[model samples]
Target: MSKKNNKIYLDFAATTPVDREVLKVMMPYFSEKFGNASSTHSFGQEAIAAVDKARETIAQCFNCDFSEIIFTGSATEANNLAILGIVKNVQKFHIISTKIEHESVLEPLKELEKSGHEITYLTVDKTGLIKIADLEKAIKDNTILISVIYANNEIGTIQPIKEIGKLLEKINKKRKEGGLSKIYLHTDAVQAINYLECRPDWLKIDLLTFSGHKIYGPKGIGGLYIRKNSPLSPIIFGGGQEFGLRSGTENVASIVGLAKAVESAFNNKVKNFKKVSDLRNQMLADIIKHSGESAKLNGSPKSCLPNILSIRFSGLSNETLIVALDRAGVAVSAGAACSSRALAVSHVLIAIGLTPKQVKESIRISLGKDITAREIKMATEIINKTIQNLL
Candidate 1:
């Protein structure tokens, strides 16, 4: 196979190319239907209708009311709104979160800590899963919220969301009986929508965050699901769009694109997941067969996102391997794209007990729905050759 024939994209976790169908649905909103959703005139009403329809479609996916969906500029913004908004009215309360969360959630918690709220950063096992008992111990009478990432971005280990939700439900019942404030659960499900079950009712989470681009939709659009009566205040104050939570003129085109993406994702979820997972399995088997003892799979062998494969090579640098793969027309990542520039040891890796050297030797290969068997085989061959060259 010619290396130049196709560019093997294995960085789906960073972002996915917008689906052509989704783009087609969004085109009219950009030019012909370009109107401010907040306006009341004809053009504006048309835009608002599109926005409402998108909200309803997404809400259906999450099993939430249309009014509960709050569209934001990005998943990072949704995470911030969920974390900061929940603590807006409280003066001093405790919050619980895992150390492996995305920075959007971590940074907001840090801000809350600075404002006198007690924050507990829970530790995870080597598999990147938190202990329910530990979480229970951490909850105090003043604990207000618990935020956890549904699926780890780099490692792909899925948390026990349903169990955590059930635990919280029991705890909330006790709190209500004691006349104490109920602790709410929020999950950043940006990486889970395509592969995992995310209905708010099923997960039993009070608040949730999602990004459009991660699911093959347009960039710069995301949504937050707030269960009715969930205690949250507005983080952004303005024209009071998005039910007074996220205020700004809506990104009508992107919202339309997001709805189309969500619809497509659910419509073909099973088929897409099975195909990508089979490809991932083939890639892993090939790497192990070719590289032997030098290769080691990171994260849980089971209970991981089918699309993500985090692998470590002993005595090799991840950056060098990534560069070599890119030169061979295969794209991959060292970790989250947002933190790639820092060149520091990944906190998620370190938290999972990887030594600094092992962390440096790890790379993340995420598969997309469009990937083919031929591309997987070609990429694996390129990776094996690159490793040999680097060694």
Candidate 2:
């Protein structure tokens, strides 16, 4: 968690504040440069230029061509487009995905199932990682797509994306020679764009989805990287914007913000990772030192996001702890923010082998680049004190 004004907010996995540089680039688009990109006038030309430049900027950061970047409303929409769009007209085909994918990816796959498509949900280990053997074995002759999350939003478990990509590359080459359908790899990189390797070529992903707000950019704008010739049909239909993949008046301001944010995140990724990781590690040490056997870390300690920590405090309800922390001006989360209001235990925790009771005892604490040593110390003290009071 990082201190913002008077509040300690530890929910970076949910969203991040727009960076000042991003805001500076975006300010003109809202009004001064306000123009429908579809218009043929000079105003529209300016707007389209901004959109093109933003697209090119993002493409460079991801090591993709300008034509590969498709802007969408959100990562959810981008993810839906990747999953549902790929098999738009094709049906009864097999798709492989992980059990721990975000609702955006999972729900679209479920929709495909209703339309006679076969889906194989791969299970993860206790540490929330998919095995390459299990994944390769799941590939049937008819499998056309494999969608997995690069990193979990709640538990912070980083998947073996690069390895999976290489595995798919080999399998895909064989499939191509055998005249089998080439399996497309798609990763929901919403949690990884700010911290991890995001190059499409290196990841060998056919499609990639990410959001702006998750990377200190504005909301309502995100991008999809569709590798050249990867079969994907448009989900949203209209004036053929975004190479006909998504059609709408582009959110010009947010698109500009997204570009700047991506640039900043890539440029500062290493430095910020070093700093936040140290703070996160130290915070874990402090909390464990104070709470002894009461505090246990969830998720993979080694193969996880540097800034996120999922902790289970035995005999404590995560909901109660979140509310108590909210009262104390420290904002945390039980799981994914989109599904937090639901009464059901987190599907993520359940998939990772947590019992229903243990799920209730776990909370997600994801840090941002701005988190401080002082804030970490204060948050640990407050969390331990609060746990003691509840006990």
- RMSD to the hidden true structure, all candidates: 1.6, 1.1
The alpha-carbon lDDT assigned to residue 180 of candidate 2 equals: 91
Q: C-alpha displacement of 379 in model 1, angstroms? A: 0.6
| lDDT, candidate 1, 28-59, per-residue tens | 99789998988889999999999999999988
Clashing pairs in 2: none
lDDT of 2: 0.90
Per-residue CA lDDT of candidate 2, range 1-391, in tens?
A: 3565688988898889888889999999988999988889999999999999999999889988999999999999999999989888775699999999999999998988887789999999888999989999999998989999999998889998889899999998998999998899999999998889999999989999999999999988888999999889998899999988899988999999999999999898899888988989998998899889989888899998888999999999999999998888788898898898885688889998989999999999989998888888888788888888987
lDDT of 1 at 25: 94
Best by lDDT: 1
lDDT of each: 0.91, 0.90
lDDT of 1 at 18: 92
TM-score of each: 0.98, 0.98
